[model samples]
Target chain A: MGTTGTDIRYLVIIGIAVMLLLFTSFLLALIFNQRKKLKYQQSMEKLREQQQNQLIEAAVRSEETERHRIAETLHDEVGAILSSAKLHLLGIKSDILDERDQQLHEKGRELLNEVIQKVRGISHNLHSNILKEFGLNEAIRHFIRKIAQGTVLHATTALDDNYKTENPDNDISIYRMVQELVNNILKYANATEFIVSSTHRGNELDMVIFHNGDGLTQEQFEELRYQKEGLGLKNIQNRIILLKGSIHFTSGSEGYRINIHIPVKSNQP
Target chain B: MKLINFIRDWSEVWALLIPLIIILVFKPAKKQLRPVILYVFAGFILNFLATFMVEYYYLMPSWTYTDGYVNNNILYNLHSFVRVLFLGWYIISVRQYKFPFLLKTLLIFYLVFVITNFTFYESPFILSTRLYAAESITLLVICLFYFFRSMQDESDINWLKHPSFLIAAGISLYEVITFFIFLFFYPLHQKDISFAAVTMRIYTITFVVFCILLALALYKSRKKSNLSGVTG
Candidate 1:
């Protein structure tokens, strides 16, 4: 066995130490590269999701515009023509015609009045002028009053007096969603009682509907929403999505309940 | 001096125990890592045989000329050859590079060079410092390749938590630090016995640390397997 001097040993040790330091630095760089890659992937996923949501929003807005146009056409063009016809028939003097002919003219005017009312009702259902002029609360009240007159199904409502939306379009969408939900109940649920209530707290709005009827479980609701026969539920879902809101359905032996929450500020525009 | 003597005495036991533990603990869970585990287990057996032959030669010095060469040197050379073969297999198996033909050609060239040097130039009885240096540098390159390819992977895997990454890191760190040490082994042995002893101590310490990292890799692989089982 021979011996090398101390200087050479010291140099070797320093060299080994340097190599270890370099390896440590390389490991750090590898970790940084991985983290940067993960962050980039996450940001890309978020951008894709934002783009999809924007597309949905644009579609809902176009649909509302089309419905408004149709409602205006039915109300202004068709209803005005029917009303003028009724007016001219009423103006025909009873003294200028025999009894049977006068009776026939009066009957024709009555039928024209009925037709005019039917057209006006359809136009209102398509796009409610009441919702645009007076806001969501009055619109819902008027809707409930109309239903109560038409059906034996007892309907009740409790809406916040202070509930106000800066965007009338948002108000119309919310009103339409509630209308769809009630329509679903009328068509499907053989329930004796339907109850609706709403509240506004800070920038949030909560609406609940309850009924003693055959109800849907969460799975059933999801299944129905994607089916062809579930257009009303689908429409309600689309409007809620447009509002950036959430809806929950609860069902039990006693009844069915739906709870909805919307951030009013987030729904603006 | 006492610590150095202790490490020298028990280094073979440590080597054998580490790989044995890895096989027993992770073999059941690591189906994908079977080849690596097999290589390690084989290396451990080869190391044991080499150590036994060297110890027997020390006990009976006159019984070494059966094949016109020292049995200890033959055993050590065989051990080095087998170790390099397995290491090459590990690298090729885990490599993500596209040029498989080029990598295989380089590996074949390295094998030819090692055989020619051992057969013609370097005596089997002498330490093959040049071959060891070459092996260390090649392994370092392979480890670097693994890191680079992993960086390019699209899947968001936590490299720090990955078993293969941990093993590659350990190998890279050990190889880089020991490359010069291997190159200077014969020179240091000829010039200074004490310096050589110190260098051997450093190598043993690095080897032990490398073994610990390997054990951690096995443990992490086992944990990952169990998690996948639970989730699946």
Candidate 2:
């Protein structure tokens, strides 16, 4: 009986030890398998995000291409036609006409000149040739200058001279976001003073805009961004997301301020 | 020999304190964790009482004895019942299984079975091997069901860090480790008392590990809730 008891003790010990070893192995397996699954899920999420960004880039690029086409057609074809019409109208012998006819011709010439000037301004705004040639800094300063000239708003820019364009695509995205925000301010803020500033710090580019007008807070921007009427703001957000950047809106004592930060990726090779 | 006796006498009782202290100190106030809190608190109390009864059953009232022997088996029997009840409640409340009616029915049936089995066939003062087997099997089934249901869930939760997964894993490991020993405990004890003691020590070791796992689960749960509170 004593020998049998000793054998049984050994057997139970072995059994429990085996059971514990097996359970440990099983747990480790479960953890590793689940970790593998999580990795796969994360990669799939990254792939989906990459695909979405590609779609947004394609849409924005196509829109820019269409704008360039329209601007070129207007500037080259329509402007030439209008200029020729002006010269022909001017060449008409006004001296041979009655006084009333001469007045009508002069008025017609004035309207044609105004139309030509307006067309030129529209073409310049749409084409973005200055942005392509001069980069984001000059483009933004030029935009602010145009705003200051064309509206009652006193707009100013203090862009960083050290800021160099590493990627034109990213620059275009930044320019578009700034353009949209400025437009929003002009259309709604009703304030007179607006300022745009940029600073390049190491590998980060920070841009801030201040306007002394009624503007959006971060919460309001979040709320408005999901509404149907906020498509422009949503597009701006999507572009910022593609650029892997962030935009913050705040209302200070003076008025409103927007801060944008983008990580500068060096794609120069 | 003294070490073995000490371990055999107090391992499970002391192990319960680990998770109990964690729950008390951390105070995971989430509604989903309430059942776990109650389970650990109640388990600690019951286990402490059982350990005390084992050491001092001779000084207790006659009603606590059977056939002139100090018998603390009733406390173990009671723990099995509480174990199923609280753990089952945790599953029902947290998992919200699809066929909740079925699980509730099973709980009711198990409760009735425990009462009837103790009243008629088995003296609660003696180790109720039947109750241990029934409890282990039931809990094992519930733990397996939890894993299966978690498999079907589409949420991208880290299963390793998930409190529910940890609880299920702890429970399942304890159940599997002790199932056979508890199943044949009565026969083995009668055949060779020394062998039975050895098996009980092994059970004690597993119980200690199980309690540590429970403590970890509670800690993880608290951390997760705090994180969500900050981010939400």
Colliding pairs, model 1: A2-B191, A2-B192, A2-B193, A3-B191, A3-B192, A4-B192
Q: Per-residue alpha-carbon lDDT of model 2 for A127-221, expressed as tens digits?
A: 78888899899999988898789567788899999998888888888898898999999888887998999999998999999999899888788
lDDT string for model 1 (B57-160, tens) is 55546766556544655655665566556655666676557766766676687788888998899987666777777677666766777777777777767666
Model 1 lDDT on a 0 to 1 scale: 0.74
Stretches off by above 4 angstroms in model 2 are: A1-4, A81-117, A150-154, A190-192, A250-256, A266-269, B1-34, B48-73, B89-113, B148-158, B180-205, B219-232
Residue-level error in angstroms, candidate 1, position B23:
16
Which CAPRI level is candidate 1?
incorrect
DockQ values per model: 0.18, 0.27
Interface RMSD of each: 7.7, 5.0
In model 2 chain B, the worst 10-residue window by lDDT is B223-232
TM-score for candidate 2: 0.78
What is the Cα-based TM-score of model 1?
Answer: 0.56
